[model samples]
Target: VNYILIDKFQEKFGSAIQNLSESSVISLELNGINISRFGKLCWLQVSTKETVYLFDILTLGYEAFDFGLRRILENEAILKVVHDCRFLSDCLYHQYKTSLANVFDTQIADVIVRKEEAGGKWPDKLRLLPECLSHHLGLPAAAFQKYSVSRQPLEQASATVWTMRPSHSALLHLAARHMPELLALRTVLLDKLMVPFTIHVGHSLDAYR
Candidate 1:
């Protein structure tokens, strides 16, 4: 689960993500800070079952809205696996007026699987990314908890600090593991699912329809 850093987004990200579209399936993880109700998409992490690519979206600026990136997102041929893509999808639509296609949200799918396992009864509780991974993939809770810590207290600084930090920095190390962990989780969870999954029509919570 080694990662590649795409610091020069305008020059390399478009081509990098475009080439990713050639794969049959892509697992994507995005992290951003909320700025005035809109997501300031700062980082985009992608994995193709083999390699992980981390893009510093802040480096791209408006150029992050490149047509190549849009094509990959909107392409029905490439299945995109994500967890809780609602806000991420909204942010993309806000930035470029485009929506994601061929998406399978693991969070939504987990709900459906859990419900099926409960024999149509409501599960007592539903879990978020960390808990879900711990249950299905045996990921250590401590590893996930470390992601919440920042070497520098980001609460007092701009969210752009995530992008400015070096790869060796504590924050970057924790944040970058998201995509690799997600890629592994997808395979493990799908095998343990008790029910068939339905592709969600949009960024809605209820995927049962």
Candidate 2:
């Protein structure tokens, strides 16, 4: 994963946007405190098949979205894969006035697939990302435990952990590592949606928008 800060943003933005534009699909994950209109968005991770770029949102501020990121997000032609898009959509629309389009939300998709597997009965509750990863992608508990350990320090520190300047390396790694799994989970869920019995459930995934 390449960590792009404000100092190198201008030099990298052009090529980054170009690569993103050419890709048919990309994976995204946002890290922050609270992550709503009222909260802070610290990092924006974008992953294509070839690379993962972690943009420092806290340092770049509005400039991060203003340059070209916002346009790519709003582009309906390219599909953006995310775990759960509610808070992400809320944050982007309210804070940046950016409407997320053509999203393939894995959380919603997971619920749909699970419901079908359970004989059309809805799940008792929404599954978290780690749970979804384990259920669909067979991610081991040890792996989840490792990630949890990496995230625990910052989370325990305070809500302001995301706001700290010169973010901890563990935090950055946590942010970057999520993209590949997220993308992989999307592929697995999509394949499950392809069965004839689940065709309607697949169509229902668009309800996320």
Candidate 3:
């Protein structure tokens, strides 16, 4: 995992953005106080299969997006796997004037999977990231203890904790952990979706025969 602050702005972050642009698919996670249109968006975690980058929105500000990140996020050719993009989308569009494109939202996918499993009834409630991780990845609680523990302290702390400069290790750890799990969850959900999709297509083909 790499932390991209003002010191590493030009070289490190620029290279990361370039690499993200080149990749066909990547996972994204955003952290902030509230993370809605009116709230602060402090850190952005972008991950490929190999590397994770934590971009410090507090330190680098809009330059972080303008430098190259915006292009990648808006680029339709690049697929971004994220969990529940509503708030992320709101924050980006309202604050940064950036519209996300080609996004695969895992939360929505999970809902669709559940709806299919229930014979087309929509789920009553949306699943959070941990639940999605457990349900899709088949990971036990012990497997994700580190991630859970890392997030709990922040949840109890003040919202301004995200806006704090020189972020704490716990916050950084939480940011670093989400992308890999999200990428894994995407793989599992995609596989699950295909089973139903394939069956539906096969039935449609039978109608022609």
Candidate 4:
């Protein structure tokens, strides 16, 4: 998988995303560092059918929220697929006051397709990302563990890690692996869901309609 770092974001953003047309679909994976204490988002990983783009938000800071990036996320024509996008949603709104326009959160779709229990409670088995990926796509448990190892260090690392180039390369590799599996998982989940899943009126994602 190809990777793009923040130092090159401005120069490469145009060319990297130029192929994203009106009908293109992109899978997204977002990771943040020190969320409760500082709420700093560290990485933004996006993947099309052919490529992966890793944007280091912590490195870019407020510039990461520039109009071009905003336009892509806000674009109604390009479908953004995220796993459980709660943290990503919170960061987007907190940083940019932007509500995602066209999004499909796979966790919400799974809940809807699995159906409510007799008492109208959602079943919990298929909720988490690793579980869904493993069950639906047969990804090994070790893969998730390795991803966690590669990511947890970056997530919990000191703020200086973002400024250091060598510290982030492996993290980018792990982050890049996420979107491809997500696309595969989405296909399997959609097949199981067998219908379109709709987001309710509230900003929070839920399984309704």
Per-residue alpha-carbon lDDT of candidate 1 for residues 1-209, written as tens digits (9 for 90 to 100): 37667877455666677678788888876666652226577777777767777777777665654646677778899888888887778877877666888987888777777877777776776566777778777877786775545522442354656556554545555556766667677777676563343333252556555
Q: Each model's TM-score?
A: 0.77, 0.87, 0.90, 0.77
Residue 3: error of model 4 in Å? 2.6
Give the true-structure RMSD of model 3: 2.3
When 3 and 4 are scored with lDDT, the better candidate is 3
Q: Write the per-residue lDDT of candidate 4 for residues 30-136, one digit (tens) a residue.
A: 77665432476667778887778877666666666573567788889888899877777777877766576798898887677666322456785656677777767
TM-score-superior candidate, 2 or 3: 3
* Residues forming the 10-long window of minimal summed lDDT in candidate 3: 1-10
List candidate 2 segments past 4 Å from native. 1-7, 149-157, 197-209
For residues 35-143, write the lDDT of model 3, one tens digit per residue. 8798888888889988888888878888877888899999999999998899899999999888999999999999999999999999999998888998888889876
Which one is best on lDDT?
3
For every candidate, C-alpha RMSD to the true structure in Å: 7.4, 5.9, 2.3, 7.2
Q: Which residue pairs in candidate 1 collide?
A: none
Better of 3 and 4 by TM-score: 3
TM-score of 3: 0.90
After superposition, the stretches of candidate 3 with alpha carbons farther than 4 Å from their true spots are 1-7, 146-157, 204-209
Model 3 lDDT, full chain set = 0.84
The true-versus-predicted C-alpha distance at residue 19 of model 4, in Å, is: 2.7
